[model samples]
Target: MGKYAHLNILLAEDDSSIRSAIKAMLFDLGIHKITEAADGEGALQNLIRTPQGYDLIICDWNMPNKNGLELLKDAKMRAPSTPFLMITGRADEESVMKALKSGVSGYLRKPFRMNQLESKIKVIADSWSEMA
Candidate 1:
């Protein structure tokens, strides 16, 4: 956590396994300030309940309820400046464009490696400096 104390990432994945893996990555990066939600509805609840608690949110597209895109809209309403990273198993251009138009901070295809995660984080961190 000390290694990346500056980041507060949220893992909004329904699968406990994937969520755990993401959390583990954060732990490896020394980022212990991560929050988790089981579904889009749960993620919304977390956003409302813990406003400003998350600097970044990584969400899965498909879920039992609410879905990641819906959560993205809600999160944007709550924190327009907050960064959102969407993860989708469906790798179609339509879905990608829709998410981009909806204001995702980043998008990563499923079956992504930890290196991909790290690289995306670096890009986001670098871009954040230019944001007012």
Candidate 2:
């Protein structure tokens, strides 16, 4: 099993191709327990349904119904302890600041490699381990 095999991840992305690619990467890392959402709204619904909550939440910046920033705020209110990672093509300073202010654990720009994703996840996981 991979280092993160025991983790349950929530992935909220509107693009099918991007979502599929991320899911495949996660699978390669031995992270099989992933719950996917086509949009932020669906993601929120899934989050609400999962009372025990997920180990991590990876979300996009833009989507139909609701956006990642909105979802991040709501999720933080509901599950403040859960780590949230914002993955998006938006690399603007304003967007980064907004997400950080909204309590995102990490931010990753789009077109990132698997190693980049892995590194981000590792940082978040390491922080959790430190807290524990």
Candidate 3:
């Protein structure tokens, strides 16, 4: 099993293809336990349902009914310890700074390589473990 196989991850993405690709990469990394939300509102609902919180949350920047930044802020307030990774096509400096300020654990620009995804996940997992 992979290092992250024990984790239960939540992914919020508006695009079905992008979400599937990310999920495939995560599975390749041995992360099989995953929950997906089509939009920010759905993500929030899932978060609320999971009181103990997810091990990690991967969200897109632009989503319907809440957007990634809004979800990030709300998620942080509800589950401060959970790690959040913002994945988006926008690589603007302003957005990146905003996500960081919003308490994101990591940010990944779209069209990211599989290696990059793995690296970010590892980094977040390590830091999150330390906090625990």
TM-score of each: 0.93, 0.98, 0.98
- Compute the lDDT of residue 105 as modeled in candidate 3: 94
Question: Which residue runs of candidate 1 sit more than 4 Å off their true CA positions?
Answer: 1-3
In candidate 2, which residue ranges exceed 4 Å CA deviation? none
lDDT of candidate 1 over 1-132, digit per residue (tens): 353568888889999999998888778777788888999998888888885568788899997689999999998888988888999898899999999999998999988888888888777767876794
- Model 3 CA lDDT for position 42: 99
Which 10-residue window of candidate 3 scores lowest in summed lDDT?
90-99
Off by over 4 Å in 3: none
Give lDDT tens digits, candidate 3, residues 1-132.
Answer: 988899899999999999999999999999998999999999999999997789999999999999999999999899988999999988889988988998999999999989999999999999988888
Ranking by lDDT: 2, 3, 1
Question: What are the clashing pairs of model 1?
Answer: 1-30
What lDDT tens digits, residue by residue, belong to model 2 across residues 1-132? 999999999999999999999999999999999999999999999999999999999999999999999999989988999999999999999989988988999999999999999999999999977886
Report the Cα lDDT for candidate 2.
0.95
Clash number for candidate 1: 1
By the lDDT metric, which is better: model 1 or model 2? 2
lDDT, each prediction: 0.86, 0.95, 0.94
State which candidate, 1 or 3, has the greater TM-score: 3
